[model samples]
Target: MDPGQGKKAVLNRSCRTNTSFLSFLCVYTIMKWALLSVWDKTGIVDLAQALIQHNFSIMSSGGTGTALAGAGIPFTEVSRYTGFPEMMDGRVKTLHPKVHGGLLGRRQIDDAIMAKYGINRIGLLVVNLYPFERMSRESLPLEKLIEYIDVGGPAMIRAAAKNFKDVAVVVDPSDYPEVVKTLSSNVGFSHEQRLIFAKKAFARTAAYDAAISNHLSNLDNTFPPILTLQFTNGRMLRYGENPHQQAAVYGTTGIAGAEPLQGKQMSYNNYLDVNAGTALLAEFEEPTAVIVKHNNPCGVSVGTDILEAYLSARDVDPVSAYGSVVSLNREVDKKLAEAIDSTFVEVVAAPSFTRDAVEAMRKKENMRVLILPERNTSDEVRTIDGGVLVQRTPAYQENWQVITDRDPTTDEMSALRIAWKVCKHTKSNTIIFADQKRTLGIGAGQMSRVDSAKIAIEKACAPLAGSAVASDAFLPFPDTLEVAAKAGATALVQPGGSIRDDEVIKAANRLNVAMVFTGVRYFRH
Candidate 1:
C-alpha cells in the first residue's frame, strides 16, 4: 500500500467507480480522526481505547505516542502522518501545515485542497498545554522556563476551538468520561456540546498565556503593560449585597472558594464579613478570636485558650457581635461550638472543627461553618467608576520609635502591639484602645480623628485607664492626643509624619502620656 495515497486514494477510487460525491461525503464524515497530544497522561489511554472502539483513528506524538504504544493501543505517530520529523527536541513536531489544516479544514469546502496536501480531517482534538504554571513556581532557570511556554499546543488549541463547527476540542481530563459516554451512545457530539468544549479550550489557552505574561512582567516591572485577569469555576450566588442584585463567586481558593459544610447559602455581605474577620485573625499566633460586623472588627482578643479568647472578644462589644462573623486562629472544639451556639452568629471560620463541635453546632442549622485556610496576600483591587485600582504594600516592619519623654511600660507595650495589629485592619479615622489581652474600645470609620478618639472612649467596655491606644494614621493635631489622655489612655501609638508632630509630642509630654512612632501608616478606606 502506498502511504501517499492513503484515505484520499479511497475517495478518488469511489468517485471513479460510478459513485456519487454525496455518498463519499457521507463516508468521510463518519470516519472520525482524533489527534491526542497532552502533557497530562491521565485518562489518555482509556480515551484512546474508547476512540479506537468507536472506529476512530488516533494520531499522537512524543510521550503520548509512547504511552499509547506501551498500553498496546495502536495509534499513528503524528510525525509519521505529517511526513515531518519531530525536530528541535520535539518542539517542531506539531507546527506543520498538515496538523493545522486537519484541525481547521472545512467539510466539502476544503476537501479538494486537503486531499491534494494529504491532510486527513481531524474530527476531535485532545490537547493540554505544558506545565508552565507549575514549573513557573519551581526554581527553574529562565532558559528552562521558556521551554515550558508551549507554542504548538496553544496554536493547535486555538485552531481547533475556532473551527468548533467541524472539530470538537477537549482540554480538561474531567470531560473525558462525557466524550466516552457520547461515543458509546453512538451519537456524535451535538453542536451545543462542541461549542461548550470549544469555549473551554479557548479559556484554557487564554489563562495559560495570562500566567506567562504576568510572570515575565514581574521580572521587568511591578505590573504588566496590559493586565489580564481570569478566574474559573464560577458558583452562582443567590443574590448580591441586596436581593435585587445578581451576583456570582469565582475562583477555587481562599475565601472566594470556601463552601459551607452545612448551612444556608452564603450572601455577599456574609463573604465580605468573613473575609475581613479571617484577615484580622491571621495576624495573631496565639489562641485569638476576631469578630467582624459590617466589614469592621467589633472585637479582637488573644487568650490562653480559644474559648477564653472568644468570650473576651465577644464581651468587648457584645451588641455589635450579634449576627456577626466570628474567626478563630485555633480549632473549634465542642465547648467553643456550644459557646458560639449560644449567640446568633452568622458564620464561624477556623482551621478545623471536631466531630463533637460540628454536632454541637447543629443546633443552629442556618449558621455557616467553614474551614478558612491560610491565604497568601495578593494585590488589593477595587473598582471605581471609570476603571479599577490596584495597590500593593511591599514587605515592611514597624519602626516602633519612642518619641515622647516617657516610654511605654512593658504591659503598655504589649497592649500597643495588639492595638496596632487591629488598627492596621480597621477602617481609617480609627482609634483602638486595648489592655494586655483584649481590646477595650474601638472607634472606626469616623469623619474626624478627634471624634474617633471620643467615640472609642465612649464605647469602652472596660476602664480605659492604663490602656494603650493606636491610631491608623498620624495625628495632625494635639487635640486627639489631649482627648485620648483625658479619657485615661496612658499610652498612644501613631504613624509620626504629620507637620504638627513636634506639638503633639510636646502635648504628650505635658500630659505625661507615652507616645511611640511607627513610621508606617495603615489607612483602610
Candidate 2:
C-alpha cells in the first residue's frame, strides 16, 4: 500500500470506520476509543491491556505513548490519529479538533458532525494532571515552574467530563481496576459511574488551578484577582458539631500527619478538639500534654515524662478533662497509655504510639487513637457568611518585658512562659493560671476579662498561691488584677496596653504582685 493509504488504514483501524452503518446499531458496534494522557503512569499498562482485551483502541500522547510502547502495548499517538504534528514543544499535540471531537462528540446529537469530520466518539478518557503541587514546592525558577502548568490535560479532561453521559473520565489510577472490571463484564461504565468520575475530574482540575493561582498570588504580593481556595475532603465525620448538622473534614495541603491508627469514626467535635489540643501541644519543646474540650484547652502542662505531663494536665480540671481530646508532644509509651486508658477521652493524638500503647488503646473501642505526622503551622481560616477570614497562625512568644519593679523569680518566669503559651491557644477573654509548669486553672471565652480571672480562680484544682497568671489580652481595669491578687496569684503576664495601664500597674504594686507586659496580645476568637 502507498504511504498515505497506510496512514489512513491505521487511522481507520484505531478510530472509527468510514463505511456507512445504520444509526441504531452504531452505539453498540462502533469501535470504542480510550484517550490516555497522564503524568502519573501508575496502572496505565494494565489498564491499556484490559482495554485492548475488551476490543477498545488506545489513543495516547507524548509520555503516555512512550509508556505504552515501552510496555509492549500498541497505542496510536494523538498526533498520528489527528494527522497534526505536535507543535510548541508538544503543547499543541492534543488540542486539535479531531482529538476533542472524539471526546466530546455526541452519539445522538452530533452524528451528522461526526460523519462530516470523521470524528470517533471516545468511550473513556484517562487523564491525570501535571505535578504542579510538587513543582511549586521546589525552589525552582519561575519559568521552569510555569512550564509544568498543564493546559491540554485540563482541556481534554473537561471536554470528556462535560460529555460524561456518553464518556467516562478517569483521573485517579486507583479507579483503573474498577473501570477494567466493569469493561471485562461487558457492561462498561454505567451513567452513575460516569457521573462520579466526571465530578472527580472537575474537582481535580479545580484543585490544580487553585494551586497555580495561590502560587502566583504569593509571588505578586497581593491576593489573586480572584481568590481560589482548594481543599480535599479527607473524610466524612459522623456528624457536625451537632448531630442534626452534616459535616466533613477537608485538608488544604493534604492531611499528611493526621491519620487515625485505631478507633471509631471521628466526629466533627472530635476533629475540632483534637486539632485544638495538638496545635497547643506543638508549641512546647518539652514533653507536654494538652487537654481540650469544646475547642478550648482546659489543661496544659510540661513534665519530665509523658505520663507525668498527662497526669499534671488532667489534674488541672479533671471534670473538664472527662470526654476531652488529649494531645501529647511526644510518643505515647506504655505508662502514658495506661494512664490515658483510665480516662474517658474521646481522642488521643500523638506523634506515635508504641505497640503496648496501641494494645491498651485498642481495649477502649470507643476512643480514637490518632498518629499525627507532624504539626502543620499553616494559615488559620474560618468561614463566615458569604466570605472567609484568613490569617497567619499566632507565633509562640519567647520574650516578654517585666514592666513591674520586681522581676519574676526564675521559677515564676518558667510558670509564666508555660501559662503564656497555653493562653495564646485559648479563646479570647482568657486567663490561665499555672505553677511549676503545670496548669492550675484556665478560664476561656468569657465575655469579660475580670470574669475570666474569677472563673480561673474558682476552677483551680490546686492552690493559686504563688501561681503565675497569663491573660490573653490587656486588662482594661484594675478589677482583674485585684481578683487575681485576692486569689493569691503572685505573678501576672499580660499585653499591658490598656488606657488605664497606670491604674492597673498601681493596683498590681499595691497588691504586691509581679506583673510583666508582653506588648503583644494573643486574642483567639
**TM-scores of all models?**
0.96, 0.92
Off by over 4 Å in 2: 1-29, 252-259, 394-399
Computed on alpha carbons, the lDDT of every model, listed in order, comes to: 0.91, 0.85
lDDT of 1 by residue, 1-525 (tens): 122335555566665575457455536543568999999999999999999899888889999989998999877888888888999998899998999999999987998788777688899999998999999999799999999999999999999999999999999999999999999999799999999999999999999999999999987798777777899989899999888999998878889889999789888899999999988888899999999999999999999999999999999999999999999989999999999999999999999999999999989999999898658677888889987799988888878899999999999999999999999999989999999999999999999999988888998999888899999999999999899888888999999999999999999999999999999999999
Q: How many residue pairs clash (N, CA or C atoms closer than 3 angstroms) in each of the candidate models, in the order given?
A: 0, 1
Model 2 CA lDDT for position 21? 44
Give candidate 1's error at residue 222 in angstroms.
1.7
Among all windows of 10 consecutive residues in model 1, the one with the lowest summed lDDT is 1-10
Where does candidate 2 have its weakest 10-residue lDDT segment? 1-10
lDDT of 2 by residue, 97-154 (tens): 8889988988778987885787767889999988999999998999899989999999
